[model samples]
Target chain A: MSRQASFGAGLWGGALALLLTGCQAGLRPIAALNQPLSGLGDSQSPSLNSNWLALISSRPGSRAQVQLIDRLRHAPVPLPGLNRPDSLPISVAVDQRGERLALVRQRDDRSELVIHRRSLQASQVVPIEPAGVPQRVSLSADGRVLAVEVSRGGLWQVDLLELP
Target chain B: MACTAVTALGLSGCSLWPLRRQPAAPAGLAAESRQQPALSGDGRLLASLVDRGGRTTVLLQERRTGRVLPLRQLRNRQPHSSPSLSWNGRYLALLVQQGGRRQAVIEDRATGQQHPLFLPADQEPQQLSLAPDGQSIALELITGGSRRLQVFSLAAMLEPDRAPGLLESGGGPPLQP
Candidate 1:
């Protein structure tokens, strides 16, 4: 009957594009992780690799997602396009051997910096360097120096002495 | 009838292609006063930066007789802001860090007084620009190994012998500091 309905519509359009690119790595990372050295809300910040985690969310509709937790196959993909489309993810940097990844985008007076290639499927868009209000995003201990500081402004014209 | 008008225009183009929802945090502002509002430079004043759980704040309002100023470095954590305003809003510029040190504050909310610009000890200034009757300020420093582009004078830190054209040629020797 018409080749079995075109092979079931090509296997349901390749299983809905692999279920929308396998929905942001569902969640699984716990090799003794405890991260909590301050910071709790307002759409979060402070996540360096493991246990330096800090993620805040304002919720209101929400838009920002990046999942990369393969602590040896615990699996949790989705890191492509590195969370664009309103890209309000603010922070995530784990370079210096943990493979490579740096992502941040802060609104209200601008701030954008991206660097990808952690692999959860990549096709492009992995450019870096464009500081603009970044405070503490260091990567050197043999990762080739990259530090930023714009800590946060408006309370006495501070830019944290202009770090490098 | 022309094939039922092309099957009702292909099911109305599939219900006019998805996403089209709006009507949020309006009708009298308060999803925390509609988030980002900053309206200084002669609009009378309005600023924003709020965070609930991680506790962040900065709201110098008065956009037409409403009066509100709870901007003491936005109390209780969650800083990392840059809420500026000083073309006639009286004065306000920020950068308040924690932990690895960082300080550069300025708030004059018509004589509320606040001024400090001190940074040196592993510089980490990731951009800041303000110049327009606000007394000059522009920085993008990153100390150690030259990555500077500074220009400031809120009556301080402008002494490259008092503005040697705001010092230039600050480069070389930094492949990654």
Candidate 2:
């Protein structure tokens, strides 16, 4: 090949190689999860685990409540006997099966922690020892362990409870 | 020689351009009045607290579709706060206020059962988080002017609510509830 022609081929070859490499290693578009959900009312305190999501929301002419949504089904799961008319839900956590829930509420004259069993249709009060006040609660994925924040002597402390 | 120089210039140009890219910004959810948002591990669901008509409530929405889900059981409760969800959204743990004090409770969605954690009259609950396995819970408590965080094992009290595929994958020995 002539010198000029060879130079032309080399330039084209370099450019083509660059183009092909760029296509192979190019950046991917943003994920759909990064997108925001619009047209929502005043809402806050969102918690998600796996395919389930739980949050607190209040709409016009409605009371504030804890809501649960199944991400796989894109629908709200019904929670019976969880919210009481005279009580205000302060915090909430959900298990993997959506079968067990742990929450704290203010009722009567004090704050307490309760566990709701779905299969048995029963609600039980898990008591804190040492007579300390309870605040926030967290549950393990297997529903085997519970972490709680307690207040004693005006200081914050964390306690682990083994449920039976 | 001219071709060689042109190729050199082109290769150098590529180096001059910035290569480190910034992460994409997260999309906005709603306007003001929304706070304390939590996302599931898979990023499929979102739960948030919204203020409406002077009351704070929990809202659950599918992140991809932006569809609002209903919470029929909590409709009557007011001023809900600090929401947490387990893997698959099966169990919801939260705190509620009744009368003058705050209480912690959990709602099981599968069977529509609500469990109330009972604390001593003097011990007051403030905030809480549930483990995704549905086996354990961590709570913040206040007693006699001090605050503390605690974790409790639920193996004896409640059955294991493991995520789908976890058990099949041999995650662990099943606990007898």
| Chain B superposition TM-score per model | 0.29, 0.72
How well does candidate 2 score on lDDT at residue A104?
Answer: 70
lDDT of 2 by residue, A42-87 (tens): 3433444445555555557776566666655645666777777767
| Regions more than 4 Å wrong, model 1 | A1-164, B1-69, B73-124, B127-141, B145-177
DockQ-based CAPRI category assigned to the predicted complex of candidate 2: incorrect
Error of 2 at A58 (Å): 34
List native contact recovery per candidate, as a fraction of 1.
0.00, 0.03
Residue range B1-177, candidate 2, lDDT tens digits: 533543343322212111111111123433334544444433344566666577877776665566776666665576777666656666667777766877666677777766666665887766665656655555556656654334454444445555565573245688667
| TM-scores for every candidate against the unseen true structure | 0.22, 0.43
lDDT of each: 0.41, 0.56
Task: List model 1 lDDT by residue over B132-154, tens digit each.
Answer: 23544444455664343344444
